[model samples]
Target: MAFVEPGVAAVEARQADRAKIRAVAAGRRAVVIGAGLGGLAVALRLASAGWRVTVCERYGSIGGKMNQIEEGGFRFDTGPSLITMPWVFEELFEAVGERLEDHIQMVRVAPLCRYLFDDGSRLEMTVRLPDWLASIRNFEGRDAAGFLRFLSMGAAALELSRATFFERSPWERPSMADLAALRRPLPLRTVLPYATVVERSCRDPRVRQVLNRYTTYVGSDPRRTPAMLSVIPAIEMLHGGWHIRGGLYRLVRVLGALCERHEVGIRTGAHVERILTDGNRACGVGLRGGENLPADVVVMNGDAARLPRLLGQTTASAEREADRSLSGLALLFALRGKLDGWPHHQVLFSGDYSREFDDLFERRRFPSDPTVYVNVPTRTDPSMAPEGCEIVFVMANAPANDGDLWDVSMLGEARDRMLARLDRAGLMSALSGADLVAELTPRWLADSFDMPGGAIYGANSHGPRRAFLRHPNKARRVGGLYCVGGSVHPGGGTPTVLMSARITADLIGKYERI
Candidate 1:
């Protein structure tokens, strides 16, 4: 295999040498845009492979959404509080001959999360399988066996998919074929339907709602999500969920340090205004300050939908017009005192979950009553908050952007409504008279991370086609351009994004070796 420049025009023999020179030059310089987890991982992987790698981040900090903030003696990790599949981090460290445990201390939580119902009933879902089963039995009698059966199916699906689908580059379509042929796998058709698992295993509406919420972790609705998602709980319960000693943000810091150790050049506050192109082939990137940083390969870790603007023109396969995933409306409250009744992580579902999903994904408006996720890291890590206080991240799914005009008055009213709802649901009583130290909304996330319309996950997983039709790892038309992130292959969440990075790295490594 030889290096090929993307988008080079055909020329006569007289100009062939010039084209070859440009192609070789393009193949030697690799630039990674966005210093998020995916970008950092790729930079580290490429650098370890002896490729000159440079990572550019628009924000002053390296972590994109995973960045943290300190306000009035309270510290909060602005995004992604949960950490799953600790091996992913371990792999990145091992790639550079280091151990993650040396960089960051992680503690596994027994009850990964707690769900509180409107009627004051609560269920603590633990990482211990026996404990979780007991909780299920307590909530809905005789449903424990059914839940176990559902988990078994999910485990099988996860095993099949993780080995075959999650580890390969999306650019290598035939890679999947080769793996399938080698393994002689069962078709996805053999797996149980997602809807059947929920309906059969859960008898109570609340129990069903609690189980269904897991789908949202991957940006899918449980009703529409494939039964393959059942593996999520199995992985969580069996393998366990972890909480980093300081905060989840510490993981980003550790990754950044690992990249530095590998001699990967990292540039913060340096934005790529445009991708420098030699005809259709990406040769390098032009920074915001009008400086040109040449690259042989370019990997985008930002939102895939926004790639066209950065590239300065749309490629043949750039689907910029596609509808995006639902964004979130968040309220990060730095309370002056601890939340009395709440656990480390809690989900308070609305009375009508189906209606809420429909409104956010279909009606394109903020749900009248939204299912809320409340995360208080201080419960596990006292360092996050001052003595006698806590940091709470309250989030609910909202329209990415409905083109509805937003006003300060409307936002204030919405906050009031959300606070009232929390009080009414008995999820939080501190909000009634507590002093707020910090608050963030969708607008903040958009402005800070450059996420279009503040959409968290790039696209929704609604239809079966959409689930399989996610953005590929490599540009179908542009050579030397690749994508690796939440918006790309293997889908969203901490573990999946790390998987995407690994797949992209392996592809780039193979190409370099050839």
Candidate 2:
């Protein structure tokens, strides 16, 4: 009554509530280093679990590689054009009391990806299995049995992945029961190498090339990357590849907004110079500006290849130390014409698939005949382009920046070759007078994304253990130091990175420090 003497009671009540909130925060503080998708996801997740979370990103803007390069009235998503698993993003939003659909409008890609072989053969992988199968049969003249077998292989791996590899602790090895669930051709073939799977399942070289390209999703070298990666194609076929109505940058914006709604503090341009530690236990982080922010738990959403240095250690375990994954050479073109007849995603296979892999993984040189991945986002989201114009994100799997090979001269040469290859493949005829908006080589990726050598997917799943034995979400040796993102298990891709974020959050719950 009497206006409570100009809101004196309300002020006191607010002070009391603030005291209680501070008391609760005293025991829980989390510092997420990076505002990438993984960092943003985990930051919101930790905040949802009552942790006072702070996300520090070196870049002025968030999203990391999942960003946009806007120029010449055209907008392009820099990475990950396809959304194979919408459920992952839905879960992310659901956990934060938001609906993914409310923030993002995604339309199912009718044909997930269109594949073009060296022989000018074309196959459109459609959302409907019957349609895809018909196209395959029409083009390759292959029986459904071979296709069924390949799908089965992918399904088996997917089943096992969801049950064992994805859900389990990265620090733990699979049990016999886990192996039983896999129920594959054999143990030797399942996890050992890709050669066995290729020899058995991939019969037609064109189909094989298409299937082999799936490994490149995680930046794995299909020639040496384990057969477990066969799950990728199945994921696309089963889960369905959806494209955001705007761009992936829309998701980034929504994620950042959700973090804000949850009261998670995100500071951009906060470069973590060092991860302060106390005998393998993370103490806090030292910002580049000589600022120290102490935290009870530290989640690193950075590329884990830099983990050892972040911890100020010389080396990582032989088992945990993974080889960096393949990098990419991206060509973002601003063209003055609408693109028709091209799916949202297109893969033009190389003439010599093995030689291409050899050039990328073995010789560490640009492939003479590179498998070109053309992404026309404007096809689905027309707003991405101007009137009568299209924005194209063309990519080629390239070697990681090895020995500074991607110099200006070298990149120019690679670009010329890429244009020639595109022309030869009949893809360049679509672009008679196209403007090159931007070219992001591995060198640019490494410099921009903190990805060592611009290894986009983080670690190459080479050898037997490489696929399954990636750097764990929970650092085996360090306390209060956890990792999530493309660099760590359970591997890269938008969905897998989200999975890693989920796993790291769970691991943090079970972490002894908290």
Candidate 3:
């Protein structure tokens, strides 16, 4: 659907209404920089709440990492093909008095994903708990019970963490009271200490590898990622994975339409040169082309780490230290023919998962045998491709950018190695005779998204400190400024970014009220 910009008359009327509301001390003028998912969500919510909102996007299109690339007769979603937590999107639509179902069609998948182990063993992880247990039983009989026990523990941990950790705003550090509440919960205490959820869940190395893979969803290393992340799978298993019709990028289009419906102003291709700060307060932003947009509040939907640079200031050492998260490398391909044997989602594990991660985090180099993720959207939605064609998204974790290693030679070699690895894993046979489609590398991600080091999720989800040590929503030194994105609070993923937007909007609402 084409985006319909709000009419000038409607915008003026909304402004007049907001002015009247402000006269009664009820509203504020807000500007959101970067029309990424987080920024778009925040803008929609605030506009729905009677605030005069404007969204500025540097890119020609919205979606940030969740962008769509079209070439020839093929189209591919560049980032985050999977959608979980449908309720988050529903909430946004509800805020605007629209139903999510009215705009986007979502289909829930039964077998969440199929995992191919290095030893050639395959396991299909299902959304149904019993089916998942059955798969575990098929692999290791008695271990099946242990798997169920583990999931039970994971479910409890999810509840505790979601309530205590995920719900709160990242701007305010949790006090002794918060810590005390977290400690009082048994499941939280049990899950909090482990380096990896798989460590406490199973004894088999393969099982550990399977569970450890969840850490990658947040751009984290299982060995160092908090155990609380086990809830990730718990939530997915309980709620199920969803596929949005017409690609997930349609979400951005729908949201952009919703923003217009609420009279929120959106400006595309508007690069923000610097955040305009009034002494210690951010009053607005300066455009690269010399246009200055004014507002009482500024919400940044770009990478949190880039905030200091955008503000034309050196990031504090503490701020820099707190911002280490996982970055990623992805390869999106538009194939000429269909792959018969592949599922919608597939995960291929390396022989030595631990050593592979060690190569990444410890040595800061690409792994010899990196775990590979393949997403064949055509498996579920044939319309995404030509009559018999397919769209494939291949991805793996790689070093963001260290300045010297991102040379073309290195990138080309990495791409060749990945394709070869897929061939060795039996994927190439399925796509035999299929034409080579478009290829997007980490460099493309960096160039397109303006993310430092091509990192997908801001910092690595390492220790508990990493989880709680996110960049604050409100700047510590700058007033009238806020950040909402994967680089900041609630962390990465589509759902989390949406939550970050809600949290940021709530903060803005509270600030305006005060």
Per-residue lDDT for 215-249 in model 2, tens only? 88888777787776778888888778888887888
In order of appearance, the predictions have TM-scores of 0.88, 0.90, 0.90
User: Can you list the residue pairs that collide in candidate 2?
Assistant: 325-460
Q: What is the alpha-carbon lDDT of model 3 when measured against the actual structure?
A: 0.75
lDDT of 1 at 134: 88
Rank by lDDT, descending? 2, 3, 1
Candidate-wise lDDT, in order: 0.73, 0.78, 0.75
Task: Please provide, for model 1 over 1-514, each residue's C-alpha lDDT reduced to its tens digit, 9 standing for 90 to 100.
Answer: 0111112221132134223333333335689999988898878766665667889998899888878887777778888888877776776666656777788888776568888777778888876788888888887777788777777766776666655566575346554444664475543532445665678776877777877787777666666666767777767766777788889888888888878887788999898898878877778889986899988889999998878888876553543322676667678787777676567888887878788778766677777777788888888888888898888888877666735444687577667656766877765566655556556666676788887777777876656556655788877777778898998887888878887887777666555333
Q: Could you give the C-alpha RMSD of every candidate to the true structure, in order shown?
A: 7.7, 8.5, 5.9
* Candidate that scores best on lDDT: 2
TM-score of 2: 0.90
The better candidate by TM-score, 1 or 3, is: 3
Q: Name the weakest run of 10 consecutive residues (lDDT summed) in model 3.
A: 1-10
